[model samples]
Target: MNTETFINQNWHDANQQYLSAALAVVRGALESYTTSLPHPPELTAQAAARQQAVQQAAAAMPAPSALENLCRLFELSGFERDLLLLCAGMELNGDFARLCAIAQGDAQKAYPTLSLALAALAYPHWDAIAPNAALRRWRLIQVGEAHTLTLSPLRLDERILHYLVGIQYLDERLAGIIEPVPQLGELVPSHAALAQKVTAVWNQTKTTTLPIVQLCGNESSSKRAIASQICQIQKMHLWVMPAQVIPLLPSELDNLIRLWTRETILSKSALIIDCDELDINDAARLNAIAHFIERTNGYIFINSRERMRLPQRLLVSFDIQQPTAKEQSAVWQAALSDIAPQLNGQVKILVEQFNLSPATIHAACAEAAGQLAQSQNNNLTDILWDACRIQARPRLDELAQWIEPVANWEDLVLPETQKQILRDIAAHVRQRSTVYNTWGFAGKSARGLGISALFAGASGTGKTLAAEVLANQLRLDLYRIDLSSVVSKYIGETEKNLRRVFDAAEQGGVILLFDEADALFGKRSEVKDARDRYANIEVSYLLQRMESYPGLALLTTNLKSAIDTAFLRRIRFVVQFPFPDAAQRAEIWRRIFPPNTPIADLDVVKLARLNVAGGNIRNIALNAAFLAADAGEAVQMKHVLRAAQTEYSKLEKPLTEAEIGNWS
Candidate 1:
């Protein structure tokens, strides 16, 4: 047999012998106490010898027995130890019940109690049964319902009973609220360094209590990886309990604290209280968590998006960021190890475009591998990029409306200069990595790196269309966020909403279109009140997020002059969406109808005579199609004329005879 197996067998034998001997000693003591000739010297001598043999069996074990460890962990006194054994005896052995009834001199009292322990066991003390004593504090022994303290039926807790037999498991009471977080294999270098740093902090500290670690970051998985790594190094298990599950009732919370504290010792584990999704507005739950943190003793790590202010504790805060660009490149190479040679510069492009955690990167790679396996002729690089975009799509979906970009460059009826500017916006997004990273512009400073644009025009002047064109050109998802609605009147609420938006969009697979931003991004007035000052703060916060954002962010407004000059200066591109001239309107009319639609002698020149922008022209074309389809005929001049009248009515403008005189 192997050395480990040999030693385990010997320890099991020794433990069993020890338990058997201890049970015999208890049984003998109870019998001697209950006998009529109670003062038999030989019986007394035999019980004393059996107690010595119990001690010897325990000493012979290769490792400390479960009972010995339990006593040491709880600091159980000799009387407390004997009292616990008395309670355990009633469960483990059947004869102890009869002995207890005979000894108590009442057939009704068949169970062991504190009163019985005092009468039957050695070194008995009244304090052993006290509420604060080790026996009851650790819940090693539960006192059953009764009239008096001494007479209350004492029973070993089911969990503690299993524990005494060398069985190990999480407490059943806590099984629903907590779960184990296993260590992630092969952490990034930066994350591994963080793990080492945490270990040093825990090891090098000289304080009587270990400092609570607060890992602050937006990447929850990275923080968990670091926490799990630390536990692996220290040879301790890691468990996660969401902060929302903290009990609100005072008594239940107290019970949770005591029970978990005992569990940490028994299971050799540390807990990570996940507060990532906890709502800050919940006052009662927050207070419950604060109390839990302060009172629960053992190794603890707080996982949150931002640092939590935990007063009255030594909190060592570390901001856990996602893997750096270089680290990410290495991670990509490792995850795509088989195809690393095939991907020449694709890894660099992916690392620049997507700010992903290692876990997410691996997941994206797995998805790509699956697709590549299906089609061997597919371009590997494109498949990988598409997979990354799919993986990065989830966070932004919850915060904004996702608009699929269908308007390409041909569909947009904008001035040549404005179209070129839109193309420049797409170019910047495409080549940012080469210019920023390869040319060392990113090294100088990270400020103003995001490609931000301001599209200013009148309503229906193709501002949103231009955004959609850029989104199609760039092959990115376009999310239109109405800035007017997002701007909350409550102080700081606007900034909170904006922060959520920017943070969720940090993964660069989508373009953020903040439409109708005139009200929020307007000229900053003089700071006369607290509200005005906070309004300026909101603008500044948005400017900072835009400067650091890794993707394209476009803001549209009706009036250019309403935007603050300072805000305009920080933006990279400002495209003016001018109202379409007659020639441009004619072009919009020409391409507005799909090739599949039937047309009958459509006069683009006359349609262009109708005074409207590209947006209105497209609406008229669509409405004309529907009218023709319903009338069972091709789209003709009358259909176009009728649709133009409806569009003009919706615009609250008069359709003069001069503009549509040639339509019929």
Candidate 2:
């Protein structure tokens, strides 16, 4: 047998011997007290010999028995230990109840009680049954209701009874509140190193003064994996408790701390309090978390996006990140091992585009494999890319508006200079891995590597259109960041909101378009008041995050001069989407209607003379099509003229004779 099996068998044999010997003593006491007969001297000597034999056998076992472990862990005294055994005998051996009634000299008192233990058990003390003693404090035995403390009927707790017999499990009181973290496969090299470092920090310290190992980062899976790996190395169980579940009521919170502390001792376990999704603005919940951590002691890990402050204890933090690009590429190759030969260097493209954890990469590969199985001839590149995009979508959906990129380069009407800049933006995103990694740009410095652009023009110009075109060319998701939702009136709230957006977008296969940037990116005001200073701080924070962001961040503003000069200096590209002149407007009018739409007598040159931007021109053409359909005729000059009037009125401008003369 293995060591565990051997130890368990020895414990069982020793426990049976101990219980039998104790019961013989109880029977002897009953016989001498009830029958008015002399207790035999040899009987007493035989009980003592049996007790000594069981103690020697227990000492010879490889591991301590369950009863011994409990006594040692709880620091139970001699009286408390025997008192627990006396109550357990009533359940384990049915005859002990009748003997208890006989020994007490009353038929009604058939259960073990404090009064019976004081009179029957050897070396008993009155304080053994006190509320603060080991038996009552650790809840090893339950005392039933009675008129007096000494008369209360005592019974061994059901959990404790099972535990004494070598059966172990988590306490039922912690069933829903605490759950085990699932063990994952082998970690990447970097993450494995982190796990080792954490193990070293914990192993170097004593159990009572162990520092709280806080894993801080946006990659929650990596944090959890490291924690679980460390526990496995340390030979302990790891459970997760959400920060929100820390109770607000003091009584309930104290109960939870006591139960959890006891469980850690019993199961040799660690705890990971997950605070990754918690809102830092919630002061009440944060305070409760502090209280819970301060009260409980054991192997504790906190998973959060930022390091939490706790002044009362020592805390060590490790920033957990996703695997490196090379490691991720290796993971992708391994995940697609069956068909990796057919990829033709496409794995490199995946690693360069999407920053994913190993777990996510495996999931994406599995999903792609499922799709490839359903159809034999599907493009493997598209299938794999789509799977990755779907996996990274759920979190970003709650943060920004996902704009489907349908506009192509042919649709946008910018000048050649601005158009080239937009194309350059796409090229930067595509070749970033080559320039930064292979060419050693990343070795120099980490700053100014992000691809950020500024699109300054009027409202109706094609700034948003340019962002869509780039997203389409690059095959990435485009999200429009609504400034109203991001900016806050409260101090420091804007930075928190922005941090969440960037952190959620860290996977790097998406575009962030901040529309109407002048609102938040305006010039920093002079510090005449505290509000002014804080406002400047918010502006500086935005600039810092934008510069450090991995993916593309595009900002559009109507007033170029209104934006802070510092922001302009940090941006890599600035494309001016000036108001479309008549030539560009004519081009927009030419391609406004699809070939499927019926049209007649549409004078393009005359329509271009309306002196409006490309956006207004498209609006007029669409409205004209609607009017012609309603009148059951092809779109003509009269339809276009009427739509132009309506468009001009919406713009709050008058259509003079010079702009649309002789349209008919």
Candidate 3:
């Protein structure tokens, strides 16, 4: 027979033996009560034989009997074991109630009670009925309302009853609060190594107390996968509970911990407290979770984005990051085994561009396969790239604005030198892995390896457009972060916000355009107070993250001198976007209007006389087009002059004839 079939048969036989022993005990108790005397010699012999039969059957089984395992796990006595069996029989067998009625001498008292067990069963102890006893403490058996402990009706817990019948499942009471973690199929090497370390720790600590494992990392899914793998290796079921949902009240928290501990013992389970969604500022919830972890005695894991401090208990922390580039390449190869040969060269590009986990890589491959199956003409590489973007889109969408990159090189009006610098930035990003990994630059050191640039100039000098152009050139997503929104007056809040942005963008390698950076990245000031010290700390933290970020992080500031000197030294490239001269302004005007727009005779030389940057010229051009459309005429010099007056008014500057003279 197969292993499953053999196990099922053995389980069946063990239950029958246990049932036989329970029935024998019930028969002996009933006979003694009916005869109003001690048990007969033959009846006593049969009870002894039944007990011996159960022991033999348990010893012969391939695995330990569920009933026996429960008893041993809970450290139950003989009387307590028999009482549990009696309660279970009442639910599993039809004749148990009749036997109980005969034993109690009253048909109305059909359910088994403590008084009946004491009078009928051998080696019974009154202390078993205490509140701290195995049955009452673990909630294995429920005692009904009664005036006396002896007369209280006993019923088996539903979960325990099902377990006794070889039907294992989670307790109904815990189902709402906890969920079973599914086992991962194939683990990356790094994750597999983590699982092995966790298993070793658990085994080494089996004799002693197991420390609460703290999985500190930014990737929640990877941590969970490792936790599940570790539990599987240790032959334990993994259940997840969100830390935020933990009760704040002492009584409720105590009850929850006790219940979970009991369930752990009964079901060979471990709990993974997911604190990724937990708010660290909420002290009450954190305290409640800490208390729960401190009091519970079982295998436990705390999943948090950062390492949390719990002074009450010992913790073993593991930092789990995403798979390395080589490992990710392996994942891509394994996932797309069929198409690897056709697209061999692009795998490295995919891995370098999108630092995806194994699970995400597999999912992206599957998505591509599905699309390919639908349309055979679809480009597999493009589909995979788009799928990777979709996977990384949601988290980034929540923290910043995703700007669709529509501006190209021709659309940008920067000088050739600045344009070349932008192109070089893309080249460095594209070839980083080749130089750092394939070559030996990374082996030497990792300092200042990140590709960061600064676009410093006046507003409307094409800083934003340049960012979009680079994003389009590299075929990567661009996210615009307004530093005003990210900077906070509250201490430590700014770092928290910045960490979220970087972590979310790490996987996809999205280009980050931090606009108006001077608001946050100003020169450090003297330590006048606590605010000054923390402000400097925030700036230091930003510089560190920028130097270490794997993707391209671009910062734009209107005032270049406001940036700290140390930060300026760390930047790889600082491109100065100067105000457009008359020549550049004239070129911007020539290309500002689309071919579709109707135009009357307009003199570019006069329009170029207006002293404005590229951004204002485009604005004036669009407003002039709108004006001409309303006036039922093509855009002429008059419309352009009128629009210039409106623009100058909005800028709070006087409309001078020196710039716009002779335009009409």
Candidate 4:
């Protein structure tokens, strides 16, 4: 049909069949305004006849009025709808008389107002709807802005609050429901397992609108893909909720709800909330979103690494992970089959180099194929290797070193007593699975449950190294926090920064080693002024996060006494590193040289007399090795002595004959 004819027919069909209570609200509004017009009203016999036809169509509807249907579509009803109609009608014609005429005998007593809305629109029965009532939500509908109810352009209907009174809660009906669930070709197996569980719950309940499901892990795409997959299967649109954009004003949230509802109904699509990437650092915003999801009609899949609680709503939870080895192998073969013969050992090695999803692997292979195609060459192995290397491009700069290690607990040089403490912390983390879950500790409190440690020592005494060791032992990544990057001078910025760190690392339990933590975690001073209060606040903030975070957090400092005693009380483990004795320094000097470094015979006992920490010893050893390499000679006692002189000069310490007496 012609566009004009098609459009006319569409509107015609809508008029004949879509005259729901939602429409009645609009009609009532129009009717209220029609009476006040200077022009002759359109309420003749013909208009009456038409209104009767509209009412017949509305009654014939299996649903409520067009107005009520709109409310239902957006999860609003009763007082909220009435409040919306009042504002909407008032908007069409800025007259309170129009609103008063529409509510005619409706027991709302007065017409449209903030006070009236609070008294009648809000009800305790519908906690989910009016969780934030008028008293709590003054910003939603502006009261008497210049002596009149707010008539600002609405983000959502101002009527939902008014229409929600005495309304019964409605369960989402799944039968005959159509939704869009996106096709996420393949993801890591752990995510697949979680998605499978979500599908089962959806099917089991026979519900179209899903309960909140969180995919907690370090893998971002894994959780996102599950949401996409759910959307594809359910025939829904994927709207990744923005971090800072969610409205704090109740009116704006209501408006968003309307917008989403209109889009869902208009397109017959579901919504996939990509909240995993959203700013979870703002507790207010995060909490607001969690609440928003509960009130939406379409299926909602929230992607976050942390366990988020949805106020009063209960969600069927799931955790996502990368695919298993067998799954990864299948993905590699599928993605690289076209060029498998051309790649020799590179394909197998590439698989081990990357920890990625089937989709990511396919993307890598496609990239390789594209690059090879451009080259006009059949050397596919080079392309695959390039792709593999590209995928593993280090996420952090030298600002943090991620050591994939070969050493274990035996490699650490702490004393015997300290070693047991280190092992005990490991034991807590290792057996926490059984103890926390089976022994009822999980239910007690999330506070003070995370594995946190305070490594007290001078610089270069292996505080960072110990963190790396623990991370390697636990099979997790180590994120060495650059204190310069995290400690913010601005208010709320510190929390925002910390939130980003925690949120980003949520996908996996990474060891966050806050080196030189003294800059941020100093003793909480008495609040004599605003700056002092804010400083204490920052420390208290970190303390709360350290207690609640599910991952491992480590703090390193030279002066443990500088830390607040209260803060120290919450930490699970404290490791002290005393200055190494002469014998211990000998061991450090012996091990400082790498296997590849050429070293001439040197008196280990004499080198031990340098009187330096492990850090200094390593620096001296490295400088001496560089000196020897330049001279094309093996590192010997003379090179060590020369390096020690430079090290002492840098430290501003005069070399004493007692220490460096036999240096040369």
Candidate 5:
């Protein structure tokens, strides 16, 4: 039999033996009391024989019973232990009620009570009924309503009763707020090392007081798995509670801490306070968590993305990184054991693209396997790739605007030199892993490994479209960050917002396009006041994050001169998108209309003479098409002239005869 089954069986046998002995003692007490009118020798002899049989059976047991363990763990005295058994007997044995009534000489007081335990059982003490007694302190046995402590109806806690019977489960009252964490089967090397550290620390600490462990990481699943693995090593169950659930009021916090600490000791369990989703800036919530950590005891862990400060207690923090690329490749191969040979070289690409944790990798593979089974011709690599993207998509969507890349290189009308630069950026991104890891460049220097670019040009010069083109070419998601929204007015808030953006985007390695970059990356002013100093700090912070970011960060600015020169020097590429000359404008006009649009006798040469940018030309073509649709006619030179006039009017520029000359 398995060890668990064997141990449980032994416990069961011992519990039965102990219960039999206790029942014999109760029978002896009842019979002796019933024949109290006169000294009956026969009944007295029977009582003495039963008492001796009970003591001999107790001594003859192979091991201490679960009841004995419970009493020892909770430090319950003989009186308190018997009181607990008396309450348990009411539930386990129906005849115990009659025995109790006979012992008490009152039918109404048939149920177990403090008064009856003191009157009938051996070694009964008044202190056992006190508020701080083992019976009341740990809530082992609950007392029901009565005029006094002695008269109150006594009953065993459902959880403790089950424990004595060798049944293990969480208490019903705690079921809603806390959940048992499943032990992890396998861990990545980094996480396994972390788990080992946690185990070592826990073992080295004195049993009376253990330091609170803080698991700091961005991946919640990995943190939880590590915590669970550590608990497994210590032969303890794991439970998780969201940090947000910690009570704010002092009284409620105290009660919760006390109850959880007691439960931890009683059940040999550890707690993981999950603060991954909590807003750490909230003072009240932080205070509540601090209070809980200060007051609680036993094995506890706080899971958060960043380290938390707890002044009242000693804490040890473990920084958990996502599985390394090599580890991830191994995980992918293991997860795809059936198809690993088929995907001989594609596994590396998946690992490079998505920085998924081991658990996520396994889950994604399982999901992909299901999809693969549904269709014979479906590509397993594609399904897995899409699943990884989907897993990494949700967290970042809330922080930035997800732009679907519908525009390819052809859609972006830039200079040939600029186009080549964009391609080089894409190439750098595609081969970064090979160059850094395989070529040993990463070992040389860790700084500026991230691909950052500056798209400096006038407004509407295809900067954003260039980003979309790169995203399409790389097959990666693109997010457009509004600098105004990210750059907070308050101190340090800007860095916090940027940290969130970068951290969320780390997994997918998605391309980040910071639009209107000049708003946040303006030239640093002389430090004349606190505001100017903070502005410089914000700029420096952005530069640091961009340099260290694992993915590409594209910054677009309409005014190139407004950006700091120091910032420009750090960028790997600066693609200047100049205004479209007359020839380029004509080309834009030629391809501006979709094939489906009806057209008639459009003068492209004359339209190009308007001296507008490509964006304005496209706008004129669209306006002319709408005008033709309303007039029920194909777009002609006349419609183009009218739209150009309206566009120039909006810009407050004169519709000069030299520009639109001979259009009609």
Candidate 6:
């Protein structure tokens, strides 16, 4: 209820009782200091009585019961437990003068002497008198042998150190504080549960050490958060792997590890290897690090993308994903609790669109609230979009594609043969994953086996539209890979950029449309010099990647002749997007607008006479609708004719008398 009450309950009576008794003895010692001491108290019986009285005064108070528990649990020597109690109690002891004398200890000799502690009423081991002695493991009790022996008050730790410290003069303030190290989420649920299981296993087997718990996930924050939770649950001090904070140089990490190991063993804490950076590329390195984490009672947690294989010699591992939707809902609710009015629907949207880790959810929610304060809004949807964008922004920018799919294959009016070929290409792309691997198409290697299609038609023969239709059908993200970004003037940079795109998108399994392929996929000029040879090399590399890629890759070139014949030979599909005929133009007009658009009986037959391609047909209809809407009139035949006139002017083509006949 109150800080004092909490402190008293957590600290217990050991430290208090130890301090009181110690002070009482020291008080008696100073009173008797002018008399017979440990020497011959028999001859001077009165002086002997005074010395004995002080000893008896200290002995009258018993050690705190907590000390007995620590000794029993840790199997500590009776002397060490008593030594801790004496240290705790002596703090409150009114014997500063006598204790100071003991510390000065005939110091014509070593002033910072451990003998004072040993010489007190209790028996102490000479070996344990050293500063680094294992006897001081109860981290609360810090004794330093510097210019003079100094006793630091004990500090409480949630870690194993606290358990060992018991009721000594542990600092209450110290125990309550956390260093506030940054964390993602607490230990993932499965990891915490697994840790409990491991602890039980350790108990059953009496194993003295713990192995790293390897987890796989997209974000490292969740892994680290899970790890921190584990240490808290186990009452262990948690530290993220020191390698992160240490420099990258060879010896730097090693030195950090040494410092880390010493501090952990001294503090009796565990380590969590938050390997959020683990991926296919770093599998070997992940395994190597996990190898080293297996040697300590200080546990290590490895969170990675996939299962890593390491010698099972003493290691134990479990996998964890970001919490389920239900769990995420709870996390969202908890994180957004402060802004419930604003977050009511925004949380749901985030849950639907993003599979975020608990840490990410909290961060996003907090950020959303902060932004809302700046924007002065009670609604959180705006903040939600910002968070979503931040999460999605890491996937590199090839060109972003927009797919407004209003028409399907049936709406397209290509020639019968071209239509059939287009349908076949769609089918091939649809069944690619199953057919390619099952049919042993990608068996020889991942090299040069992807499905590459070339769309060779006039500028607007539905090439881009077809790419969108297929992408929508496959339910995959479509990226129009900017060739300018992919092609490099520098030697070999072209291939390097291409590899980055392919490698990053390997998991997303996106469809890449390399628009205007003629710029790069040109006929190889004769090997006139090294530049020409490099140009040929670039073409060869593209061909291999297109074939080897395990996804659909489409290259659209307006001029098929510009693409090398050799490149065409390796392409699995090449569909020509022919110029639109009268019939095709009519079909494009019929489907140009949605049924909801208000039209004043515009005839698709009359509109088709303009002889524009599908792309231009859609553009003209859009312009015409805006013009009609602004005039507060329905879109009629006159609107279509005027839009067409403007569209033809832009194309640098004149509307023929036969095409525009009887338009008004």
lDDT of each: 0.87, 0.86, 0.85, 0.64, 0.84, 0.62
**Candidate 4 lDDT score at position 628:** 94
In model 5, state the lDDT of residue 63: 76
Better of 1 and 3 by TM-score: 1
Candidate 4 segments whose C-alpha is farther than 4 A from its true place = 1-181, 184-267, 270-403, 406-411
lDDT of 1 by residue, 254-292 (tens): 999989999988878999999988877689988998899
Task: Look at candidate 2 and give me any clashing residue pairs.
Answer: none
What is the lDDT, from 0 to 100, of the residue 302 in candidate 4? 62
Which candidate number would show the highest TM-score if scored against the true structure?
Answer: 1
Q: What is candidate 1's local distance difference test score?
A: 0.87
Better of 2 and 6 by lDDT: 2
Q: After superposition, how far is residue 450 of candidate 4 from its true place, in Å?
A: 1.3
| Per-candidate TM-score against the hidden true structure | 0.93, 0.89, 0.91, 0.51, 0.90, 0.53
lDDT of 3 by residue, 519-559 (tens): 89899999999999999999999998998888999999999
Q: Which candidate has the top score in lDDT?
A: 1
Residue 510 in model 6: shift from native, Å? 4.1
lDDT of 6 by residue, 1-664 (tens): 9998766664555443443443344344333432435545554565455556545543543443344445554455645554554454444343443454454444233221354445543456765545455454334345643554433223223333444344222233322221233433444455567657656543455556554566555556655666566566667666554323323444544544444454554444666554444333444454446445543345565555556666654655556555665677778878777777445566655554455667667767777777877886655675665564454333656533433444566666678887787678767766664554557766766655577899998888888888877766554556787887788788887876676666544433367788999998899899999888999998998888887765678899989999999999999899989899888898888888888999988888888888888889988999899889999999988888888889999999998998879877
lDDT for position 564 in model 2:
87
lDDT of 3 at 300: 96
Best first by TM-score, ranked: 1, 3, 5, 2, 6, 4
Question: What are the per-model C-alpha RMSD values against the true structure?
Answer: 2.5, 3.5, 3.0, 13.6, 3.2, 11.1
For candidate 5, lDDT tens digit of each residue in 1-664? Answer: 9998887687678678777777666756655555658758887787787778767766766677777778788898877877887888888888888877877778988888888888877887899988887778778888999998788889888988888777878788776678889888789888889899889998888756689999888888899899988988899989999987877988877767767877886779999999988886789999888878877878899999888888869899989899989999999888888755677688888987789988888888877888788867577777888778767764655458999998887677777999999999999999998898899998999899889999999877789889999988887889999666788888988888888898888887489999989988989999999999999998999899888888899999999999999999999999999999888887888888889999998877887788887778778889999899999999998899889889999889898888878876
Summing lDDT over every window of 10 consecutive residues in candidate 3, give the lowest-scoring window: 25-34
Off by over 4 Å in 2: 1-62, 86-111, 153-155, 339-342, 593-612, 616-650, 654-664
Q: Summarize candidate 2's per-residue lDDT along 89-202 as a digit string, tens digits.
A: 888888888888987878999988888788777788888888788888767888899999888899998878888776777788888888889888889999999899999998
Task: Report residue 84 deviation for candidate 1 (angstroms).
Answer: 1.9
Candidate 3 ranges with C-alpha deviation above 4 Å: 20-24, 27-31, 34-62, 98-109, 146-151, 375-378, 593-610, 618-649, 656-664
